[model samples]
Target: MHRILVVDDEEAIRKNIERLLSLEGYEVATAPNGQHGLVIARSMLPDIIITDINMPGMDGFAMLDAIRHHPELDRAIVIMLTAADERDSMRRGMRLGADDYLTKPFRREELLDAINSQLKKLARFNREKDNAVAKATALTEEKTREHFREQFAGSSFPASQFSGYTPDGSSGFGVSLPPESSSTQTLQATVMFADIRNFTTMAERLSAAELAALLGRYFELACRPVVAFGGTHLKMLGDGLLALFEEDAQPQEDALSHAQRALAASVGIQDAVGSFKQWVQEQYGQRGLPSFSVGIGLHSGEVTLSRLGGMDSPEVTALGDSVNIASRLQAAGKELGWLVVASIDTAQLAGECLRHGRQELVSLRGREKPVAACEVLGISAVPSLQQTHPPFKYDPASLQAAAVQNSEMTARAAKEALKESLWSLQSGSFQSMQQSFRGYQIIRKLGEGGMSDVYLAFSAAQKSEVVLKVLRTSLSNDAEMLRRFIQEYAVLANLTHHHVSRIYDQGFTDDYAYIAMEYLSGGTLKEEIRGRGTPGNSFTGSPAQVHGRVIDLLRQITSALNAIHKLGLVYRDLKPDNLMFRSEGGELVLVDFGIVKNVGEHTVGLMPERLVSTEHGQVIGTPYYVSPEQATGQEVTHRSDFYSLGVMLYEMLTGSRPYKGDSLNELLARHLHAEIPRLPPEHAIFQMLLDSLMAKQAIDRPADAMGIWRGLDILANKTGSLPKARID
Candidate 1:
C-alpha cells in the first residue's frame, strides 16, 4: 500500500487531506505540524509527504531540507501545500527537491492530480536511476557536476546552501552566517517606503500561508509601478518595500528629475494597490477576507548604494538620510490618514508635474527641527509612455510632441481655440469649468466639497440633464477618495428603487473622475422647507388638507427608507439636503449616498463610522438627525434610519428639530438625555406616533420601515386625514 503523510498546524486541513487520500485507497497518516511529520516520516517511510509551508515549529521549507538530507526518507516524494502568495516558499521547496506543490483551498481533483503526477515522476525516476548511474561512471567528476547543474538549471532557488533554521522561530539549527558584500557606491537618489496599513491587526484574522499569499501579491503589484517609473526596487521590509530612483550620472540629471520620477512612481503604486484591492473584492470577496490600504512616503537626497551581506545571501540596498526620511514619511501617511506623503524638498523639486495638498511641519526622528512636508496627489498630466507598450523607452522627442499636442490647440482649430487652450494649460486646474466627462458636457457648477465637486451636466446619450459628481483636482489621485467615489456607483447600481436616485454612468478621464446620475430640478427638501418660512404659520389651507398632505409625504419617505433597509443598506446621512423631488414626476428621491453603509461590513479608514462604530469616541452622521446609538458611537442598524426620519418629521411639522443646544456636544447630550418634546393635546394620535418613532432605545421603536408605514397609515385613517391620492 502507498503510505502518504499529511501535516498542517490546522487540524481541519490535516484531517481533510488525510480523509481525501484515504478515500483514494492510500494509507494516510496525519501530523499536527512539520516537526511531528518528520518523526512520523522516519518511522512510516511514507511513499509521499504533503506538508504546509507555515507551521508552529518547523516550517515546510526547513523540514524539506531535512528530508532531502535524511538517509531513509531522501527519496520520498514531497508535495508542498502553500497559499497562492507564498511563491518564495514554493521556490525554496523546489530547490530542496520537492516534487510538486498545491495552493491552499485547492479542489479535490487538483490535489489528486498533483499527487498522481508526482507518483508517476517517481516511477520514471526509479526506472532511470540504474541507467543514469551507469552513464555517470563513464564521465569525469567535473562532467558529472555539470550534468547535474544542467538537469536542475530551470529551478529558481538561489545558489546558497540550504539552511535548516526553522522559519517558525523554534529551537533547531543555529544562526547561519550573513552574506558578504561585493561593492558599494554613493549617489543622489529619491527613496520611497510603502507600508501596508493596519497589517498587524489584519494578520490576526488570516492563516500564515494566507497572509504570505496576500503579502506576496501585494508586493508584486506594488513593485510594478516602481520599475515602470524608473525606480529600482531595493528590498521588502516585511509589510513594506524600499525603492530608490537615482539621478543619471552621465547626463548629470538634476534633483528635480529624480523627485519627479519618484513622485510619479508613488502615484502609480497607489493606483495599482487600489486596483489590486478592487480585484480582490471582485474575485475573493465572498470568502470574507479583509481588505487593506497602503501608505507611501517619498524623499530625495544623497544615499549610498551597496551590495550587502555574504555572497550566498547578498542584498542590494540604499543607506542614508533619504531612506530614513522616506520611511518616516510612510509612517506619517498612516498617522495622518493620507495615502502618499513627501518631504517639501521632494515636492518642490517635482514642480508643476505634480499636484500637492496643504503643507505641514512634521517632526522627524533624528532631526533637531521639524521638516516641511506635503501630500502628493499624482502626475498632473497623462504620461507619454502610457500610450505605448513596454520596453517603455523614454524618448524626449516623443514627450515634447505629446506635450505640444496636449498644451496647444489642434491644427484645424481657430485662434480662439488656441487662446482657450493656453489659458487652461496655464491655470493650476487642468480642466476648464466647461470640461466634458465621457459623453456628458458640464453646464455649470452646482457645489463643491473638500474632496469633490458637483456639476450640472447634459448627457447626450441619455438626452437628459444629469448631475456630474467630479473628484477635485488636488484629490484626483487619492486612492481612498477614488474608491469611495467608485463605491457610490456600485452601491446605487445594485439598488433599483423608484425613490432612490439612479446612476446613469460613471468613469474616470485623463483630467478628472466623475459619476453621472439622474438630475432632480425640483430642488432639495431643505430649500422647500426654507421657502415655507415657519411651518405652522406658512400653510393657509384647511386642517384636514394640511394633515393629509403631511401624511402623504411621510408615507413616501417611509416607503423609501423601507426599500433601502430591505437591501441591508443604511443612509447614514439622511437629512433635508439629501431628499430631492423629481422634476417630471414630483416624487421625492434619496439623492446623496456619500455616506451609505452596508450592514456588517467593517471597512477601515476615514468615514468608517458611517457603517458601524468599530471603536469608542468616534461618531458619524449629521448631528441634528443622528440616532442616539450613532451619537454614542454604537452599532447602528435600520432603526437608526427611523430615528433620523422621526427627527425630519418633527422638523416638517414644527419648523425645528426636537432637540436643540448651543454646541454639538450639548446637542448630542440632548439626544442622549433630553426628554421627548410634548405635542398638542388635540393631535394626540400623531403625537403618540412621533413619540414612538423617536424613542431613545432602539428596541422601543417600530420594528421596520413597513411597520412604521402601516402604523402611520392606520393613524391617518382614524383621524380622517388620509389623502385622496396616496404617493405610493
Candidate 2:
C-alpha cells in the first residue's frame, strides 16, 4: 500500500484527509502542522505528503524545502492545500518543489484525482528507473568497460587512432608505458571551455565553506549536459571545466557531428547552471546570495593527445593550438558579454543548430592573425538556459546606413523636441549628434531628469534599440552623485520582474556614466492619466469600465512594489512619472529607482534640509505624494510606498489631489497636519481603502504591498470591478 502523510493545522481537516486516504486502502499518517509533519516524514518515509500552506511554526513551503534537501525523503510526492485567494502562497509552495496543490474547500473527487495523478507519475518514474538499471545490468563486465572506453575515447580521439596504446595502471586516464616508451596520437575533436561568470567576486562575498558547497553543487549540475551529449568530462579548472567530443568511426559520427554534440552539451550545461541559479534565488532570495551566470565557448580542430609530465606523475592530456583557441574563445565570450561564443569553424560545422550573432575578429594572445568568431545566440530549437538580454543580431550594412542618418538627424531633432516639452531638458550641455556613447548611436533624446538625460539609441552590441540614461557630465566629478547613479544600476541589475525595466549594460566613459536598458515607448502612467483624465470627469468609459481600469493598474502597481520590497529595498518615490508602460506588452514597468532605500540603513539626506521636517532630519521625496513619515524625516519602510501609491490612486479616482498647497513647504505641512478629504459616499469602499493606505502612522496602514493588493482585490470584487483575469 502507498503510505501518505496528511499535515494541517486544523484537526478536522487533517482527520478528514487521513480518513479519506485510509478508506482508499492507503496507510495514512497525520501531523498537526509542518513542524510535526517533517518529523513524521523523516521517520515514516511516506510515498506522498499532503500539507496545508499556512501553519503556526514551519509553513508548507519550508517543510517542502526540508524534504527536498533530505537524502531519502526527496522522492516523496508532495501536494499543498491553499485557499483560492492565496495565489502568492501557492506560487511559493510550487517553487519550493510541491508537486501539486488543492484549493481549500476542494471536492472529494478533486482531492482524490490529485492524489491518483501523483501516484501514476510516481509509478512511471519508478518503472523508468528500474528499466535503466536492468539495461545497465545486461552488459557484461568486459563490455561495460569497453562501453566506458568508447564514451571517453569518443570524447577525445577514436579508439582506432589510439591503437597499440596501453593504460599506465595509475587508474582512470593515467598514462603508463614501458620505461622507455612515449607515444602520442593526433585526432580531430571539439574542445569546449565553460566557466562561471564573476566567480572571483562571488568567492570574495561568500565564506569558504559556503563557496565550496556552492561549487560542489555547480560542478554536479554542470557535468550532466556533457555526459548526456556523449562528451567526456576532462577536468575542472577551479570555477571552470573543460570537455571534449571526438569523431567516432564505429558510430559513423564525423567531426561535424562532434561539433554539434559539443555545442548541444554547452547549451545543456548553460541550462543546468541556469536552473541551479534559479533554485538558489528561490531558496535564499536574491539579495544575500550572489548572482550567478556561466560563459561557454566551443572550437573544433585537430589536437595531439599525449602522455606528459614527470615519471611518477605522467598524465594524458590534450596539447595543441585547438585547445588554446577554445580557451581564448571562452574569454572572448566573457569580454563580449555573451553566454556562449564559438569559432567560425564550429559555427559552420554545427550548421543549423547554431544561431549566432555578428561575426567578429578576435585577437588571441599568441596568435598573429585575428580569428573570426560568432557569438552563439542559442541552438535553433533549444531555448536559452540563462535569462538575459536577447542576443543582438548584427547587420553591418543596415547599421552603417542607420549610423550615418542618425548622426545627421539626432541633434537638430532633439533640440526641437525638447523646446516643445521643458521636461526633456536637463541642466547640462547636451550631447552632439556626432558623439557616440558606449558604442550606441544616439537616435534622439527621450527625456531628461534632474540627474540624468535619457536618449533613444541603437546598441550595436545588442543589435536593437535601447534607452540609454547618462548621468550629467557636470556631476561626474561629484562623488555622491556618482554613487547614487551607480546604485540605481546595481539595484536594477539584480531585479528580474516583468513590471520592472530590464537593464542590459552599464559603464562609464571619460565624459559620462550610462546605463543601457529596455526601451519602452508606450509613455508613462502620468501621460496615460493625463490622456484619460480623472474618473467621472473627462473619462469616456462607463463607471464599471473606469473602475476596472483602476483596479488593473492598482493590481500591477502593488504587485511590482511587492516584488521590489521582497528584495529588501523600499521604493521611496512612487509617483506616476516613474511608472512606465511597455508598448509591446502594455505592462506597467517600475522605473527610476534613483531614490530607493535599503530597508534598515539610516542615511542623512543629500538634498537641502529645508525640504521638510523629519525626526531623521532627512526629507527626500516628491512634495505632493510624500508620505507623512517622509515629510517628518522618520524611518521609512514598505508602508511608506503604499501612502504614495494612495495619493496617486486618489488623483486617479477624482479630478484633483486630496490636499492642495501653494508651495513645497505648504505641501509638506498639509501632508503632516491636514485631514484627508472625504470621498463621495458612492465610492465609500474605495474611500475607506484610500484612508487606510494614507494613514498618518505607518503601523495604521496596510502591512505590506501584498496586504494592499489583497485589500484592493477584495474591494474590487465587492464593487463589481474585479478583473476576470489576474494582471500579473
Candidate 3:
C-alpha cells in the first residue's frame, strides 16, 4: 500500500486532506507544519508528500529541499498546496522539487487526479528502471559468455563450459575445462601485467609464511582494482598478474573507453601497492626488508584468448606478442625506476593524455623494432573508481615453511588455491579387454553401485592416479543414468576446491560412459567410525583431544560444503560413505554428486533440473541421514545438506546413527518425527550447533554452510584446539 503525508499550519486543512486520502485506502499521515511533516516523512518514507506552500515553523519549500537531500526520501513524490491567487508561491514550490500543485478551494476530482498522475509517472519510472537494470545485467553476462565462447570455442555444447559464471572471470580461469578443450580466438584488447619490483629479494629475506601472507594480501589488493574498472583478472603469473580489458567492457562511466578503464585500473593497482608497501614495512621493517613496490605495464593490441593446459585442469589466459610486450614493459619499469609503464598504443587509446614522467622508443627483447612507450605517473582525468575484494576463503597465516621451500613464485598459492585444482590426460584407444575405458588402465574395482562400478585407474593421458567410474554394461543403454553420470561430471567440473574431489576427464567408449577423477585412498569417514569397535564411546581419547579431532573434521567438511553451497548447487547425498580423505593430504573431500541439483538463482550452464524423478512419494537420499524435508519428497536445498551434517556429527561423537529402525518405513518415520540426537554430557558444549543443524524445519537450521564452519571455528578457539581463523 502506498502512503501519503499532508502538512499544513491549518489543522482543519490537514485533517480534511488526511480523511479524504484515508477514504481512498491510502495510508495517510497529517502534520501541523513542515517540521513535524519532515519528521514523519523520514519515519514513514511516504510514497507522496502534500504540503502547504506557507507554514509557520519550516515552510513547504524548506521541507521539500530537505527531503530531496535525503537519499532515502528523495524518490518520493511531493505536491504543493497554495491559495488560488498565489501563483508565484506555487511556481516557487515547483522549482524546489515539488511534483505537482493543488490550489485551495480545488475540486475533489482535481486533487485526486493530481495524485494519481504523479503516481502513474513514478510507476512508469520504476518500470523503466527495472527493465534497464535487467537489460544491463543481461548484456554484461552475454559479453562475458561471448568472450568465454571465443576463448573456448569448438565444444559441442559451448554454453555448458561456464556454469560457474563470475563476470570478472574468477571461475572461468584456473578451473576445469571440457574434454577436448583446445580452442582459441584472437581479439583486440588492452592488457595490464603487474609484478613485484624486488620480489626475489623479499623471498630471500622473509620467512615462507611471511612471504605468502605478503603475496596473498597483495594479490587481493591488486586484483580487486582490475575487476573494479571493468577488466578481466585473467591470471596470477608467478609473482605477477595478467589482466585484460576488452573493447566490449561496460564502462561504469559511459564516457570512459576500455583503454581508459585499463589505465585507471593500473593507477588503482599502483595506489593499492603503495598502501601495501606501508603494511610490509610495519610487518617486517625490523628485519630490514627491501622496499616494497609494484611495476605495472599496460599495452593494447591483438591477443589470442584460449584455454591452455591438460583436459582435467585447464586455465584461461591471453596469449600473443601484445601480452609479451606488456610483460616486458613491466620488467623494463624496474630499470627505469617507473611505477607504471604504458606502450604508446595504450596511452593513445586511453582517450586522455597520460601524465608521462618520461617517453622513449625502447628496444624490447624478441622484437627487432624498438616500441614507443612512456613512463606514466598518472592520469589526471581518471576518476576515483570503486574496487572490490574477493571473499577470504583461506587463512593467510596458515602458510607453513614448506610454502617457501617448494612453492610457485606466485605465492598467493594458498589463498588462490582456496579461491578455486590440478588434473591432465592424452587420448588413447582401448587395446585390451582389461585395459578398457580409453586412456586409463583400470587397476581394480574399488566398489560397485547399482548402475556403475568404481575403479582405481592410472591415466596415461593425465599420468596420475584417478578414480574411474564406468557405467555397468547392462545400464549402458539406460539413457537417463548415462545422462546423470555425465551430469555428475558437469557438476564436479565447476567445483574446484581442495576439500572437493577433482575431476580429470570423461568419455564414452566400449559401450560405456566413464569419468576419471582424483583418487582418494584415505577411505571414507564411515570406515573410520566402524574401526572404533563397539558403540559406547567410540572415540578413544581425552575429552579435549576428541573434541579437537571432531572440530578438525567438521571444519574441513563444512568448508567443502561451503564451496558447494556458494555455487548455488547442493550435494543432496551427504552420507559418511560419500566423504573421503585425499591420499596426498589428509583433508576430507566431498564426493558422489549422483544426486546433486542446481537449486539457486545464481545458476550457470546447469539450469534447475530434477536429475531424478520425484513423483509419488519418492525419496532421493538415504533415509537414515536425510533431512525431514527430504524424507517427505519436498524441495531440497543447501540447508538440507546441513541436516545430514548434523547426523554425521552425532555418529562421530557417538558410535551409531542418530535415528535407527528395523525397516525403511520405520527408519524414515523416525527421521521425520524423532528428536534431535544429543551429545553426551561430557561433550555438551557442542549441543547448540547440533540442535540447530538437526532442527526438524529447514528454516531453523544454520543459515548457511559458512555459518556452521565459523561456529565450529569458535568452538575450536574456545577449547584452544585450533588457532583462531584469519579470514574475516
Candidate 4:
C-alpha cells in the first residue's frame, strides 16, 4: 500500500529492483539515473526512495541531497543501493540522509527486509508526528504565559511597573485604587470570569498533595484556551479563573479576535476537564475530579489597569465598573444554568461564529436591574480556521415570550376566590370540605388521570383563576414518586418558558395533596378530538383552520421539546393528552413531567423500566405510541420521542389511532409487528416527517428534535398556506 521510488543508472539493476519491490506489494516507480530520480522524487512524493550511491550525471549522493531539500520528499525513507563497497561511499550516502545501505548482489530477502525495516521506521516517525500535533494543541495555553509577559511588558498598564511589590503592602488583597486624574486616559476593555462549578467538593475529597497536583494540571489545561485568544489571566478565585481582553498592541488585530480566543479558551477548558473526569472515572472508579461548568461575562468600558502593594510583591490588576459588572454577570449564570454567559456587547463583538448560543436574563445581587446574558457554545470566530467547533443555537427570549399572559379578567377572579377557600387551611386539617367547595366556583374538571383530578379554580388574593390538581389518597403511599413530584415543582420553578406550566403553590389538607398551577382555558387534546372528530374539534374553532393550527401546535411542542432536551433530560411521556392548546394565546403547552428522565451514556437500557413498570413481564407507555424497540424492553433515546410524536401526528390528522388492540398484550405485539398507518393525502410535508419519525430503526430517525424543527421551518416557508385538513 506504501509507494516506493527506485533510481539507478543500469537498466537491468533498475528493472530488477522494481520487479522485486513490485512482488513485495509496494506501489513502485523508477527513474533511469540520479538526475531523473531527483525529478521523480520531487514529482511523486513517494513514501520511500532507493538510489545508487555512485552513478552518472549526478550520483545518488547528489540526488539524495536534492531530495532532502524538497520539503515534501525530505521525510521519505531513502536506501542507498550501490556497487561501491567503500566505507567513504557508505558514509557519504548515510550523511546525505540515506536511510539504509544495500550493496550490489545482496540476497532478495536482504533487500526486502531492508525496505520493510526502513518503511516501518518511517511509519513510527509519522506516528510521533501525529502525537506531536496533539501535544502542541494541548500546550497552546502553556505557550501563552510567555507571550502574555511580553505583551504585558509593552502595554500602557503600569501595574507590573509600580512601586508596590510586597504581599503585605497597600496594593494587596482588599485594597482600593485612587481615583483617576483624567477619564481620557482609561482604555475600554472586556473583562471575563470563568468559574468551574463544584470545585470545592473535588478539593475536599482529594488529599492536599493530590489536589495541588490536580489543580496544577487543570490550570495548565484551562489557561491555554484563554491565551489562544489573547486574554490574560488576571487572577484565580479558588476554582474560578478571571481573564481580561483589550485591543492587542498591534492595531491590525481586532478586539474580536481576542473575544474569539476567549471563547476558544472556554471550549478547551471544557474538553480538558471532561477528558480528565473521564480518565479519573476509568482509573479509580470515581469521577471525583470535580464536575465543572463555565460562565463568561464580557462588558466593554474604561478600566484602570494597575499594580499595588510594595515593590517586592506588586500584583497586576484591573479595577472599574466594567470589570465589576462582567464579574457580576458571570456570577448571575450560576442561577441560570448557563455555561458561557456573556453580555450582549460581548456577543456583538464576539460576532456570529460565537453568537449561536441561547440568551438568558438573570437578577444580580445589589442591582435593581436584571442583566441580559448569553451562553457561548463553541469557538467559531474565523472562517479560515479549521471548522471543528460544534454549533449550538438556543433562543431563550422567543421561548420566554411564548408563555400565556395572565388575563386581567381571570387575574381578578383568582385573587378574590383563593382568600376565602383553600388559602386559609395552609398548615392544617381539612375542617370543612363543603365550605371550601362553596367558597370558590370550580368551572369544571379539566382532567382526571390515574392519581389526580384537575379543576379550574378562582382565587381572591390575586383576583385570578388557576388550575388546581388534587392528588388521590390511594397513591400517597408511593413516597418516592411523591418526593419526585415535589422535586419537579422546584425544577418547574426555575424554568421560565411559556409552554411549560407554571406551578404557583403546593399544599396538603390532612390526607390530600394538591398543587396550584396556571389555568389554561382549553380542554385536553383527547377530549377535543373525541368530541369533534378530525375536522371540527371542540377545542379548535373551525375545520379548515384546525389542520394548520394543529401543525403550529406541533411546532410549539417541538420547540418546547428542544428546550427540555437541552437541559440534558428527556421527556419520556409525550402523548396527545399531555399536550393542551391554550386558546388564550393559541399556543400548545407541555403540562406533565411525571415520566421525564435524565439521559446520558449509561442510561441506554434504563428508560423503558421507569416509564413502564413490568406487569406480568411487560413494560409501560400506551402501546400505540411506544417505539417498536421499547415494546420489547429495548433502550430508548431522544428518538423515542419522535416515534411518539409521529403517532400523535397521525391521530391529529386522521381522527383515529394508528394501531389498535383489545388488550395491552395485543397492543404490544401489534406495535412490534404492525406497519404504521398510511398517511392521508393532505399535508405531504407532514406525512414525510411522520414517515421518517416512525421508521423501524432508531438510526433511521432524525438525529434530534432540532432536525425536525428545521424541516418544519422549511415546510412552513415553502407552502404559502398552512397544511390543509382531510376529512371523509
Clashes of each: 6, 3, 6, 40
Report the C-alpha lDDT of model 2 over 469-543, residue by residue, as the tens digit: 987432222334555666677677777888899999876542456899999988888877776644443233766
Candidate 2 least-lDDT 10 residues: 160-169
- Among all candidates shown, the one with the greatest TM-score: 1
TM-score of 2: 0.40
Candidate 2's error at 590, in angstroms?
0.8
- Point out the higher-scoring one by TM-score: 1 or 2: 1
Q: Is candidate 2 or candidate 4 better by TM-score?
A: 2
Q: How many Å off is the CA of 640 in candidate 2?
A: 0.5
lDDT of each: 0.64, 0.66, 0.67, 0.57
- Which stretches of candidate 2 lie above 4 Å from their native place? 1-435, 473-475, 533-539, 600-615, 722-728
TM-score, each model? 0.43, 0.40, 0.40, 0.37
For 9-75, candidate 1 gives per-residue lDDT tens digits of: 9987776676556534466899887888998887677779999888988988888999999855776
Candidate 1 Cα misplacement greater than 4 A, ranges: 1-431, 473-479, 533-540, 600-615, 681-683, 721-728
Candidate 3 has a TM-score of 0.40
Superposition-based RMSD of candidate 2 using all C-alpha atoms, in angstroms: 24.6
Off by over 4 Å in 4: 1-158, 161-186, 200-209, 224-233, 248-261, 264-295, 304-321, 328-338, 351-517, 520-590, 593-728
- Which scores greater on TM-score, model 1 or model 3? 1
Candidate 4 root-mean-square deviation in Å: 27.6
lDDT score at residue 325, model 1, on the 0-100 scale: 81
